[model samples]
Target: MTQSDFDDGNEDDVPEWADRVMADVAREVRRRRKEMKWTAQKLADRCEEIGYPIPRNVIANMESGRRAVLPLVEVMVLAKALYTHPLRLIYPVGYVEEVQQLPLTYPVDTAKAMRWFAGLNENYQADHRMLHHHIAHASALERALFAVQGEERQRWAAERAIDDTARAKALRTQADFAERAARAKDELCQVRSAIAADGEPLPDLPDTLADVDPAEGYERDTD
Candidate 1:
């Protein structure tokens, strides 16, 4: 599978629309960085301390709108360093939402979910990222498997074609969870009462979802 050709260019080379988006990103990043009272060097150090390495100059260039190729990973790590959601870096001003959505079993309180997300720190974000990927890297298989019966339809456009190496690599986490979820029958099915009441042990799992790990990937409901 070939890698996606992400657009990356300097302000001079990027088109006006692209430049405006970059400037918006820069302003938000700068605003968040300043809100935390963190210097560019501090952000660099923090990023390196975890795993990824980004230099101060890179941060400076990004904040100054000189750097155009803002890797999604960079945005994630930078957001962690700034103690804010990654969406804060890219979404328009005065907007508020979880950097990403949490995949709960059922009956999730949307407000509570937002609060739970807001409370997460860098420590939690790594696992959270593992639980859900940026919308850009989600697979069609994942997108289909994630939703439940009769919820309003979510945005389907974020479902990406394959070849997301970094994200797909991280997607390997917790195969057992997928196994369990796949084996779980619909609780509300009318005919399911006989099977459930029979108290028969679950049969061996189907091969379809064998390697699927729900945590590592799922499409977002909205932008």
Candidate 2:
């Protein structure tokens, strides 16, 4: 028998199982790209810009199940570009089940997670503060521009009005941030309570954590 026939594993010459796996990978790549609102050409351009240099035709071939087995580095590049894990592309379905069955040897990073949460809380508070500042400035400008008359006056007044509107909108956004901060604080409290109930030392909340209290006259809701 010829080498091609021998490689095919039968006289009927069916595609190998490896081909199917590659096809699945390709399909997933295309599917994720589409989900991210990117076209094949757009994805190719992004890949090239990111130093991966995948051609449109190669992408098309892979999506169409004609190409098999991408390089490991290429798989990693693709996953980074797609904002997904490399294993999601490489492993077949149900592989995560196998991962879960493995023993957990590493300690969970509760401190890191709490730190991240606190950082987000601080960012939200900063946004709210900035928004409040803008609102105050806009309101002041609107008040200052009220006495002028003429086209120049009219223009300034209109601009101030727009700024005032923006300020109001910013206030609403600030309220949203406050609500989110409150929820995060509640979560932290719950976690602390759980730890206390277990007779463990109370984990200190991160210094980055924001103090969000509606009773302090910080508006919790704007509308």
Candidate 3:
């Protein structure tokens, strides 16, 4: 078997958990390939058509548990070629249920929140930072109100009270941007998910587009 390099550690010897995961992947790949009645070469050809080339022997080795590491990009391309979601390849059936059943420190939305942050514009991010800074200042001031003498505490509290109006205005603007960003992300996911479902039947054409080439326009009513 030809050697494959893994980023986790020594390329020659892989960890047990990774090996187990790869074993599951190997089994899933083999199962899906058989379900589609496709030869390894055919799968390879499809992958190449999509710009990721996987040779037949490599596919064989991967299925036979000879390959130590499957690159992430290859797994995604393989899932694309095999006509299924990448999650189905990496995780077992009922995996979503299993994950939801486990206790966690943070909400699952945290990952999506990070992605939303990453996609923010520089101006929007600056606004976000400024809002956060203002919030921190308000919070610190509010806390100091409890620790100070009578007038000093009142003064600290008054400062936060004075900023409340401006803070609310800034937050409203950020909220608008955040809502639009979320809607755009959801729309993007829906479209890409439709593309990933390559084996499924296409959606029916819209009423206006049914039965005619767009360039020719709708067939004129002919008696």
The top-ranked prediction according to lDDT is 3
Worst lDDT 10-window in candidate 3? 96-105
TM accuracy, model 1? 0.39
Q: Give lDDT tens digits, candidate 2, residues 1-223.
A: 0011123224333344345445546767887898899988988887888897888888887788667657778777788888887656644243212111112222123333333433444565356654434444344333323322232334444456557776566555555555555555555444444334444454333344423212332222223
RMSD of model 2, in Å?
16.8
lDDT of 3 by residue, 46-138 (tens): 899989999989899999988978988888899999988776776535322221111221222322333343444445535564444444434
User: For each candidate, what is the lDDT?
Assistant: 0.50, 0.51, 0.55
Q: Between candidates 1 and 2, which one is better according to lDDT? A: 2
Lowest lDDT block of 10, candidate 2? 96-105
TM-score of each: 0.39, 0.36, 0.39
Q: How would you encode candidate 1's per-residue C-alpha lDDT over 26-113 as one tens digit per residue?
A: 7778877787788989889999987899999999998887786787788788878777777566553353322212112222333444
Clashes of 1: 1
Q: What's model 1's lDDT at 7?
A: 33
